[model samples]
Target chain A: MMAVRSTFGRTGNHPDILAGLVFIVVGALGLWAGRDLRVGAAAMMGPGYLPLIISSLIVFIGLIVTIMGLVRDNERLDVIRLRPLLIILVAVAGFAYAAESLGFILAAIWLIGVGSMADRETRLREVAASIVVLTTFGILVFIVGLGVQMKLGPF
Target chain B: MEFLDSLILGFSTAATPTNLLFCLMGALLGTLIGVLPGIGPTATLAILLPITFFLPPLAALIMLAGIFYGAQYGGSTTAILVNLPGEASSVVTAIDGYQMAKQGRAGAALAVAALGSFFAGTVSTLGLAIAGPALATLALSFGPAEYFSLTIFGLLCATVLASGSVIKAIAMICIGLLLGMVGTDVNSGSERLTFGATELFDGVEFVVIAVGLFGIAEIIVNLETPELRGLIAAKISRLWPTRDDFRRAWPAVLRGTGLGTFLGILPGGGATLSAFSAYTLEKKVSRDPRRFGKGAIEGVAGPEAANNAGAQSSFIPLLTLGIPSNAVMAMLLGAMTIHGITPGPAVIQNQPELFWGLVASMWIGNAMLLVINLPLIGLWVRLLTVPYRLLYPAILLFCCVGVYSVSNRAFDVALAVGFGFLGYLFRKAKCEPGPLLLGFVLGPLLETNLRRALLISQGDPSVFIQRPISLALLVAALGLLVLMVVPAVRKTREEAFVDEES
Candidate 1:
């Protein structure tokens, strides 16, 4: 317990409690979602049956985690960092949206350009160089070599 | 005699120019990604899985297998040079390995790691050749009750070995099982949780989850840390280790190989646990334990050997019983399924060429890695200086293309992006995703076996306890659970992981 406390001692919040609560909420949500499925008997189990059992088990474990959280004062939750997380997510999302309509070259260019923003040291010239190199590689590897039937350019 | 014949046949198959070329490509690619920060084998395999569609099945399987073990070799190189483990299995390598680099013995450390890994890989390959067919015969006798029990044991053991919070690991496994239950029910042919989408009918693609969680989530986590941190740029001294260093490392390498081979054969025991346990064992057995964290060559040799051996031996369960011991094996199993080959006892009988060839290629791949890595160490070090800003975007683009290529569906790409966010959230919540992945891969099999066992027994759950093998497995699982609950043992486990975390 002291080890747990020391590990989480930095933030002074009850991370275990938060983690426990998150698990519980997720479990409950899963159970609620799986409720419509039929829970057949053990002899001939239905698809919903295992979900109901597993989700409840998760909730039980979550309860134990919550109890541990309350009894022990331990490490606090880390402050969430939005910059890197957001930039990466947005970059991937942009590529996903653009790749179909915009073609591989443009989609890849957009990805490198925006993803470079995640690092403060990133320069326009570096991003441009990366874009040129990666797009060509992607074309040769994915299309020419692997024979993936994707558009070569946005024509 | 049969083993020798098959091995010869395997060598013949694997030595073909096409197979050798594929193996080389896989090893090179595996090392490339493994040396790069933020891209592990799991992500690389997932992103590259689509390429298998274009290759012959045997070549594809051989290549994928090469990537799996080759990554272990590269992961150790990074651990030695950069103090950052390229994969989870190399976490302990970073401890003594980085210290060695700092002490200007980086070249020695890298050589020891590669040589140790090579030795382990060769030994494990031999073990696989001898033991794989025997284990497959043993698996031929397993019934549904036994299979279900085996999965239970595997899941429980994984939970026990998981880094933090047993309850959380169990929760993750449950969540994984739930997610796996998505799509139409195979039995009744009715949709279970598809929510009326046609894509949902096929269920979630494993590639999407793999890329999102391992690939995309890693990028986000890495990005949170400072982009330009201090790396211990030790001068590359002589590439070869001294006689004294060799003498010290060989024994640890042999011992670690032995330990790892044994552990790798067990369900839920794989490279990561073997490496950690090997390190602990070395610390215990060493005459001067204090020298361990201060650049002991034994530390690098033992864990590197153990992880590589463990990585190879982990293939045992997958080939013999058609059960994956870890995420990488799970991905391989998925790939095999896509190629219309169901992995199980029948594989030895049905696909001897593929099986023996893959086993033989592993040895060849091991040799290839030893040759490929030592000469390329300087190149990999150069790769380390490539800015994460540029590296990550290329990875992201590849991930996008990879997912898109799977079905020519933008939906899967979108799905990967969504899971990437969830994966980041899970990491923040202090949940380890390993058990979740194991559960996800094994979920359907677990469910199938569970239902089958019950159906056979007419609703009697006692069948699990009635069968001797099943009973034994469950008892062992129960004992493991009890051990986890025992405060003292739990503390020791936590300490072991904590030591690695530092």
Candidate 2:
């Protein structure tokens, strides 16, 4: 069973070490560029000076991360689960496309039906029931009640 | 007498049926969204922000303010009942609220929160009603440098708000500042950091970044869970605080109102600091300090109260001085600008009804929230259980339509999509979406103001120091910067800092 706590850990990767390494390299480049970019102002403050200062601050912060990552911090490797994620992405894309095509009610019905079906155990009949119930209520509330505009179809 | 006249006028405007309805809708919607985790008010406000384009400025401000604190109230419910915080300020609430729930005292916890928040809001709003005109005068005396320094002050306090780690928070703040630097330079009319795209000229849209980060990114993250939202099935009880709960909560509410009201006027660190400070103060004053992380009612009462109070107070800087304290306020200011209502000391004098009406409506909106939320808790809980897969497509559709409706630009919708993916990347890279949203909202204002101020000063830097208000703000910002590097402040949360390494 995937616990709620564990479910959130996939937000990022092998914790500090790898993240630190990336920040370290990026900061180093920023620092190098800042050193070159720091031209002294003659008439007014050089435009690059403020940014150079900011860039150097980034470098120092990155260096701190680099050192911290080296000295024995336990970081876990997180793996992404792709299947459901892909399905969600596709469902969202489909909803975007069909939203104007099928009209809000029909489009919403199909979107809810198909999106919920991403779970293997979800039955077509159950999804259909949910879709019919929700979309009908949505049309009543949003279109009829609230006067929200929805283009149902191209025709 | 003049103030009185203005107050009466404002009440007239606020009393309009359309404005009242908007206020009620804002509060009701705020409570609904606030109770649900993963839907922060920033995104919701951004998505709805365009509605103000067609509304009078007072109504727009009234509604946005309702949503802000209303969300604060709503988040407390989830914190108490579900052990999940819908927004950052509620993190402190969850510390004791969840404990209260586990111990079968969630009813008392929520009741205490509601009552305390109500008291705090009332007291602080009165505070605003009294002090706002004076502050508006002080703000009227301000020059460009003063306003500029105030903006710097808002940015500087991100240090105090550096949630987990000071170092990482600083890094993020700097990154936010850099991101704010994107789009065109108002001074030169030269584009910066757009990679030369025409869309780059306007800079990033708040709707795009906010929706991408908070809405779409939340959906993507939720997709990984493969379960519905609100996994916990907390049992709720009566909606009244016991005498003992009231006795314990009253002092906390008072302290929270004071702290929140004061901090809220400071510009940047208002609501966030008020919540954290209230939590700490409660723990310090608690008869049993250890009960803090457990289900202590004071913990829930104080922070919730302070958070709401702080939210109410934050508007002072924006309304009086025309200097926004945070991203949401910046958006409100933008809404005002879109309506051609320039907020300043003059606003109160010229449009007394708009100002006073808004103040009166805050009182009204808070009352509405307490009434709507308490009995309707079960309704929100039911809404929370709506499975993510089934619910998300609807949200996505609304988001697209909402984006398109405001801009009527297909490019805006497309931009939203790109930002959505980037939002996911930022999440995976350990960045908080809040500051990024802040950057996008404040960028145009910061750039425009900086240029205008400089143009007035003829490119002189000393103008910031010469102006008293600006000087004070600069001093505050300087103080914050120094404290960020202080060992005492930095040492206490080394673990929190380490977590921000990414």
Each prediction's DockQ against the real complex: 0.57, 0.21
After superposition, candidate 2 runs with Cα above 4 Å error: A1-79, A83-155, B51-54, B98-106, B165-196, B199-201, B226-239, B268-272, B290-295, B337-346, B452-463, B466-468, B493-502
Deviation of model 1 at B350, angstroms: 0.8
* Predicted candidate 2 versus true structure: per-residue lDDT over A9-61, tens digit per residue: 33333444444554455445444533533333422333343445555666677
Alpha-carbon shift of residue A40 in model 1 (angstroms):
1.9
Best-matching candidate per TM-score? 1
- Per-residue lDDT tens digits for candidate 1, residues B394-501, read 777778888888888777888898889878878877887777787888899999999999999999999999999999999999999999889999989888788554
Evaluate candidate 2 and give its CAPRI docking class based on DockQ: incorrect
lDDT of 2 by residue, B1-502 (tens): 8767766776777878988998998998788778766567876776676556667777788888898889988888887777777777787888788888888788788878887888888888878888889988877776656766766677656445545444555565555555555566544455554555786577666556566556666676766654524444358866687788888888888899899998887756566668888888898888789777867788888888899999899888777866666666766775776677886788876877777888889988888888887777778767777555455655655565555545544456566666676566555545555554454445445545665677677777787788777888889788876876888866754533342232
Backbone clash pairs for candidate 1 read A8-A75
True contacts kept of each: 0.69, 0.15
Clashes of each: 1, 4
